[model samples]
Target: MRRPQATPARVIVFGAGATGARVVRMLAESPEVGRVEVRDPDTARLRRTVDSCDDSVTAARGLEMPPDADMVVIATPTGTQAAAARAAVNAGASAVTTSSEISETRELLALGSLAAENGVALVVGAGFMPGLTCLLARAGAAEFDLVDEIHVAKAGTGGPACARQHHRALSSLAIDWRDGSWTRRSGGSGRELCWFPDPVAGRDCYRGALSDALLLVPAFEGVERVTARLAATRRDRLTAPLPMMRRPHPEGGVGAVRVELRGRRAARRHVAVLGAQARPAQGAAIVAAATALHLIGRADVSGAGGLASIRDTGRLLRAVADRGLRPCRFEGFTLSRDETPRP
Candidate 1:
């Protein structure tokens, strides 16, 4: 759970789907939360998930809501971050998001301003993958006094629905952040990165397919190079459906994340973080809900306004534990010709 601000907070999460519910469960069980409110366009789904919780949260549709909610977790797709951030701050609350690197939503740039104006925070890209990966980068950059390079890799089992959503539409442009500018890498232009030190699997690199490295590299500073590689369960030439636009309830599956940081150090080393939810409908709800409460409780979230990162979420796992959810495990080490652990 996030550490509490001076006053008890009430949180609202948009899009009451799988991940949203997880974030909610985390919030309801949190001591930091005074009242839990959930809002979604889908009233039926909202009612159903609310019933499962311990009578802590009041569920409502988008149009009707409580006087004020302290924080909002935008569990919507990648494209909706800007609108979601606006809605939450407008409603007198801070915001959190799962759209790791939502590029299409340029309106997010104004969140800092809105948050400043409202005296409430509007944070984005706080999901497990980018959020957690960024945390590792921060930890690494801090661990090593002088840093020159940074690299990140993630692999996981995606739901059939999310995969299909990827197929729903192809991202018109593949981009990343560089020196405060957006640079487009050719769509499907990246090469296969050999992943060697997965926490679950000791050392095996799979064929890591496409990603938005071009846009993200610039946003990350003090690094000579930064690469974020992704591995999904099935890699067809076909792209997965866009989760930002919509979320289709897919069949069951699991997913994991593995990241590495290489800089001025003697050798290229790997570090990993993993997250997975089984039983699509229920699991997704849990992820979303869990995310919401986690952010509202963070001390890092200044005056209830600003962007929050996954790296700032170790405390949230405590609430995950309260719900009997297991936090992702961390394991792995630098590789040397003779240092690889023997099976």
Candidate 2:
């Protein structure tokens, strides 16, 4: 069962940085949306984003969300996402955020309960790893009656500060699902080689600690093992996090995720893989747009819950692909019970 689609007449967006600006522009391109308002402390960024969009979007500075707004998107830094999300839900609007700090997010599940009670959607971690990874896992899990394990890996190049931040974030401790409960291990300690799809295959990756799958994967029955990995070239790993480096050069990159399952359909094993060559900014924009549309009832979210889950996996994949932002591909294959897994 699913709710009827109700196009949002008004939408509000917080933050006007690179990610925020991109989300505003993409939302404005949608004809179904009515008014799109952007709020940010930086007037210059506000102006730039507003100038990029059509007349339907306006710069809303030092202002509150219109109670009539159907949805509010928070694209600010991770540190302030909880506050922004809390305010949006309290203001009676559906909320979405692309935050990397989901574990530290305060009371978001509690707010989701309130939103559900109020007939609104409150979704967190709508960005890449949390966003697309969740969707891909769900889609793959659907193909089999017994999901055995899932692994998600993403690789990309950026500035030294960005790399350092990513390293520190996941370097603390890694958690994964195993034997019906969660297990802990050292971050970047479990080294494994993975063969991603073309353009970035056969790379060595280390298990990462930060992943929204920690929360979502447990929901699936028979999912005993779940982990996420991040890979960088040896040179990039050695130099990208160097604080003394004035600038870092671009490195070849690719993002890939896969799921393994065993089911009764044919007493066989199944594998599904999703890969893409994309910038983090592009992935964030695609996800933010999908979340907005889902919140407003435009996209099909048949089995979605209070939190983030892409129930209508095909629709979500289509939405992201239709955006034409980057090179993306998907595939599903079957293997024998005795076969050794590759990547």
- Tens-place lDDT per residue, model 2, 62-158, is 4466678878888776666777777777777778776655364435655656765566667766766566666666655666667777777766533
Q: What is the alpha-carbon lDDT of model 2 when measured against the actual structure?
A: 0.63
Alpha carbon lDDT of residue 132, candidate 1?
A: 42
- In model 1, how many backbone clashes occur? 50
Best by TM-score: 2
Superposition-based RMSD of candidate 2 using all C-alpha atoms, in angstroms: 4.5
- Cα distance off (Å), candidate 2, residue 126: 1.4
1-343: candidate 1 lDDT, tens digit per residue: 3454777787776766656666677677778787777777677878876887987787876533355667777766556566767776676676765554435334564466766576655545545444444443544454443444445544442343344433432333444434445455543335454342324343222222223242235334555555454543334324443334345344334444444544433343333333333333343344445556555655454332212234354454454445543444344543413223224
Candidate 1 TM-score versus the reference:
0.70
